[model samples]
Target chain A: MTSQGVWTPEVVADLLLTAESSRTPVGSVTGRWPDFDLAAAYRTQDVGMKRRTARGERVVGVKLGLTSPAKQRQMQVDTPSVAWLTDAMELPPATVVPRSRLIHPRAEPEIVFVLGEELAGPGVTAARAMHAVSAVLGGIEIIDSRYSGFRFTLPDVIADNNSSSRYVTGSVQVNPDGFDLALEGCLLEVDGQVVDSATGAAVLGNPAHALAFAANQLAERGHALQPGWVVLTGGLTEAVPLAPGSHIAAHFSHLGSVVIKAD
Target chain B: MPTGLAGQHDSRTAVLNAEAAERLLAAYAGGEPAEPVIERHPAADVSDAYAIQRAQVVRWIAAGDQVAGYKVGLTSRAMQLQSNVDQPDYGHLMRSMFAPEHVPIPATMFIQPRVEPEVAFVLSRPLRGPGVTIADAVCAIDCLLPALEIIDSRIRDWRITIVDTIADNASSGAVVLGGRPVSPRAIDLRLAGCVLYRNGEIAATGVGGAVLGSPLNSLTWLANTLGPLGVTLEAGHVVLTGSMTRATPVAPGDRVSASFAGLGSVSVQFAPEQQEAAR
Candidate 1:
């Protein structure tokens, strides 16, 4: 076996412990392996961190970011990236957070799906991915870069878990067949003031499309959707920044609403 | 007691070892270039790539995957030449990536997540065939709403070729909708303005006309583009034509607002982290 094959759960656990204890941003580890593939770096990094979680850390839903066309152009890429989620980063709906913990953070309204079975790739199709879903809910994803300037290239961000920080989901589920998801209104409010607005259709025209795209993407990489996997699908609106004493609300037209507070 | 280490590399359980090699090769030598590489091939072959991609998509759909919808890319002229493509290309959006409300998302979700102002269209009628006009596209719309598109890139350092991105679905990402829903005939979409703000501060600005000189133009082009493929946009689908302006990054504890002139306004906020702050 190659030296890289020496990676083990213990190694991953220790790395997560080190990162958490030292609070060292993964960016600092960059030159340590200059030839490391960015995507592989992310998976390797997660392997270490995930090892800790497997020992008792709660697994939260995965975080989906880069749900914008302009961003894809800016990054010179055509596909979005994803990261693992853990319960340690979850916040209740309308929960207020402190402003000082993040270097840069933004919140976006997104449609979340819970898988009823494992969805994996190679031959995974959009219909198969949808069939694996058990429920759908409205949620807000908070993205933050541990990097100081919030100016990472695509590789930097990928290694940083796509800058996923915290997520808050509302308590509602709509069967995949129930609503016209592609065309639903989404209203976001801050401090009782309407700040941003759009519709579910804005995301590649509908949230379901994001699923199809993601499913194809994972399949291309030989990964399939597994049961119980919660995919963040793409964002349904523009991302808003987070600040203290701010209240955010997302009204998903027919689906329902999600509320959060920053204190 | 074990056998020789030779050829043992094939028995490794790590998925990364095998995948990384292929990804690296594809990145460097395969048809998929990691960055823009000028190939002196005929224009016909360049265009043929689109057909090839379409065939691949059809195979997947026939394999039991549904065509959830379509994503229109390079609607802007600037984006057209940036990737060295003379025209725009399309990709499929599936159902597996859809997200629902109340699900907490970790911050490390995307490669380079950013938000752009947009306008979304829900068609009341189907659009098909050539000779489709902007007026036809507009007439088919059910409602129009202000939208924020969260775009991300899958390539490292956000470096990619247009063909690579086209295969990746135009880098389409998350989308947020707000503002009031207005009928297609309500106002002059071209004259509309889209002003975006972060933390109550103006971050980026744009106008509807920026989207291929009126969002309807995007649909018109999209319809014509799809006609050759025997694809027609069905009713009840949302069409996000393109962005009205540049995208901006969002942060936690921050609020974002987008104002579309003559339509209405919308907003959202990100939660804060007291624990990290308490440290």
Candidate 2:
């Protein structure tokens, strides 16, 4: 209502930032602006990123969302999208998460890529995407959506940075050249029970493709994958909820296993 | 309830809450109940216990389970006194908590299970507010359903304080709702008498008046209590009113049933003991 009775990118970004900062769950952004499209959503996301940068948070990496064909169909979107990750979102080694500061969060396993060289492209192929990689690491993405019930449309989620909150990376880093990433397997366990399992192919059938997808998506948005920047491929399985006292672990075929205690 | 990060015996610390929740979830997974959580966090209040309960609810919902409703516990004055509590507590009822009727519940489902009969409230209209009254509960109540709540404790030997039981989801194990749905206004629930039969013989009998004077009052209490927490007794949500009788212990191969006058009946049969159940 501030500008022509429509939600400007600034207004939407401010609303979202407030929601995230206060850990308050609000309705989806699309609910307020019914006509917002994918392009405008990216603008709002950029606006939110700028706000973070102004607050002393630097962009650390890039991540993809809806890379799973199943998730794509569920979100009614044909392709995956990219979002920025800041240093403020990292959960360092042996650090306990501040549970009271976060709303309900869920953990999803991801394939992470560390870049050796900067790359920008609108037509980045999977092979070209792999050429920039220095090493690949295992990661657990902690997603806590600001939207109530995690219900959001494509544009709604994009503007919210795809519910990105916190993430932790594993130690074992392997070169991608000889890796059988398409067949890479992951087991998500909670309380010693194997709850869900998936292969790297679950994310666009080889996470390299997802990396390439992120590059092209970023090119259109005037950004590039930079050297030393990590790229998190989308979730391989449905994210499991994180609660105080829950013990969750992810076992990867090539990358080392990671365990996190919700505290 | 947070005593900061310092080791203080005056209150329940946040770390201890998480650790306590881990203990409960571990016992749930291992099928071996642990000692009472209150003993470890002696200063943990009802609010801290609620915080622990909510943490588990977050875990269950993430595991692809949906919360079907809420349950009111310790509504009877006598039962409240026995538990040394002046007020009742509520817990989240998950969809997975509904055990199938007529089928034998596995011996491994709970650690030392007990049975209690209740008159469940099915809301046709959502109930929310700081001022929800019995009349409001009456209007929103769609129907009364016969229900049998199988109570189980994650705390060993059921040595539970009010906080202990609250943190353990009011000792909720599973629920079985059966028989016909009675209209809210069609029956006077306070006078509804129930005869619970275990092994085909009378084991317990009680009237709905035992539940906070009337079952409707219990419904009112739940709605009013949950309002400040930003939760609503949603339409189509099932609310299990407080138990009408004392909880009776049940072991493997036990057949339990309760029939309410002018309402309906519900029952459950625990499966016979098996060697594999030891796991």
Query: Which of the numbered candidates is closest to the native, going by highest lDDT?
Result: 2
Docking class of 2: incorrect
Runs in model 1 deviating more than 4 A are: A1-34, A98-101, A216-223, B1-279
Residue A51 of model 1, lDDT score: 66
Task: List, residue by residue over A24-95, the lDDT tens digit for candidate 1.
Answer: 544423333445456554665466446648778666556556656657778787777766677767787667
Cα displacement (Å) at residue A87, model 2: 91
Please write out the lDDT profile of model 2 over residues A61-123, one tens digit for every residue: 988999876788799888998998999999985456666788889999888999999879899
Best of the candidates, TM-score: 2
How does model 1 fare in lDDT?
A: 0.62
lDDT (10s digit) by residue, model 1, range B105-160: 22234445566677878788899968898778878999987766666554455565
Question: In angstroms, how far off is A157's CA in candidate 2?
Answer: 78
Error of 2 at A152 (Å): 74
Clashing pairs in 2: none
